[model samples]
Target: MANIKLALVDDHNLFRRGIASILGQVADFELVLEASNGQEFIEKIPRKMPDVVLLDLQMPVLDGTATADYLREHYPLIKIIVLTMHDEDRMVLHLLEKGVSGYLLKDSDPDEVEKAVRKVMDEGVYLNEFVSRAMLRKMTNKTTVVKQSTLYNSKILLSEREKEVLKLICEGLSTAEISDRIFLSPRTVEGHRLRILEKTGTKNTAGMVAYAFKNDLV
Candidate 1:
């Protein structure tokens, strides 16, 4: 397999170095770019576009939120993994809605950082426990605020098979795993996944999961 090019964008030099060092140990990960802030990252994108970016939410010039928005608009294919200290539910939900591929805390285990990079590359999203809990809490709170009748009327708008696939997806199953469970070929499963994404109008799994939770589809 080709090397998975990665970029790190954070204002903290020590933290950035630590993450770079951790990811450097992975055989297939190549740290191709490093930026102190979002503007620098965006300016350097043309030189060597990475397959994934480890972004920080707090910075001096152009924070992670704006950087994420720019990348989603201009380079939608490049996966973004938010690596920051902030774990607030609102921030997590905001980034997910902005189409980030993953969110991780700065204090997360090194192994998890490596895993997040790889998973996002393969599955297009990586929802760790922190992100999952945040989504659930947000969903639970929203359920109480929104009327049950309104929530029920927001139709799923998915076929039965598609709904099955989506449920498995929201459960964190991979395409291969879903294929095995549903007795469908991997290619067919991928087809179903694409259809689900189209129907949900979501850019990636993170967005899809967020949509499912917000709409009580899962």
Candidate 2:
């Protein structure tokens, strides 16, 4: 397979260069383009067409949010991975809702950066443990407009035990952690997780959390 082409867009010169250097050492990654701001990144998109873009939230010419909107509308296939200093739940949730492929703290280790990039490329989404829990908390905090009947009509009714497992999963617990808390074996916890996904028709953990909250299941 070809190396994954990546673009970096951040106004901080030193930080951008540092990441460029780090990505340069990776065998499967190529830093094909760098931009100081979102507008520059957008202008270069037609020519560079990177497989993934590591975007900073705050930039001079245009912010990451607007750039993300433009990209999602015009270039839906290009995956966006947010590399930002901010970890506020609202900001992260906003970007996730904008359809970003991944989220990572700027201070993350280089190996984690590479891992997130590769996961987003292969699995379509990557969220750090912190971000994932924050997203779930924020979702459950807000009230959804979808009626309960409309949301659950086609889905299997969740047993009380399954709801307990789903709640822990959304809390970002590993299978073993959940098992210890709930007095079930890890394999049984995994079974519950898979069943919850199937019953709710969600693709992954993030989607499962979203569905649980939107349906007021937790």
Candidate 3:
């Protein structure tokens, strides 16, 4: 298979170069483009489109959030991974709502960077430690609120097997991994995923997971 093309958008030249050097050593990754800010990225992306982008939240001309919005509107196929120091829950959730493929801190290990890249390429989502912790805290609070008002066994009826599949999906298991764990064929697992999406009225896995969380189904 071809190397996954990657772009880096940040105002820090030294950091960008450091990440570029690291990705250079990885056989499966290619550093295709580098930009100083979101504006430059927006201008350059049309000419040198990449498969994935490692973006910083804060930049000079344009910020990551604005750039992410632009990408989601115009270049939705290019997967984005936010790599920044900001770990605030509000910012994390905002990016998640905007459909980022992954989140990582600037202090992440090189191996973790590689793993995040592979995970997003293979599974379409990767949440780092800080983001995961924040999300878990939010989920817990939401679950507490939901338990009091909403009945767990309500109108939304799903089979026990489908519920198990949805739980694994919320836990970030890929279709093939869920199949392996449940001793089912990948096709069957995919069918279950489709059914789950239909039952939840979600268009994608991320939406399905969000629905599950909102309803305290996980």
TM-score of each: 0.93, 0.70, 0.84
Error of 3 at 35 (Å): 0.7
On residues 1-218, what C-alpha lDDT tens digit does candidate 3 reach at each position?
A: 99999999999999999999999999989888999999999899888999999999999889999999899889988889999999786677667757788888899999999998898888777866676676676677865647732763375778999999999988888989998999999999989888987786654565566556656677
Candidate 3: worst-modelled 10 consecutive residues by lDDT: 144-153
Weakest 10 consecutive residues, lDDT, candidate 1?
144-153
TM-score of 1: 0.93
Q: Which sections of candidate 1 miss by over 4 Å?
A: 142-156
Question: All models: lDDT?
Answer: 0.88, 0.81, 0.83
lDDT of 1 by residue, 1-218 (tens): 99999999999999899989989999999999999999999999999899999999999989999999999999999999999999789888778877999999988999998999989988998988998898789777864537642654365477888889988998889999999999999999899888877877777888987777766777
Worst 10 residues of 2 by lDDT: 140-149
How does model 2 score by TM-score?
A: 0.70
Residue 31 of model 2 has an lDDT of 90
Query: Of 2 and 3, which scores higher on TM-score?
Result: 3
User: On residues 72-180, what C-alpha lDDT tens digit does candidate 2 reach at each position?
Assistant: 8888778898999898877776666567877889889899999889877775667678776775676555444246536574566888999899888766567778889
lDDT of candidate 2 vs native?
Answer: 0.81
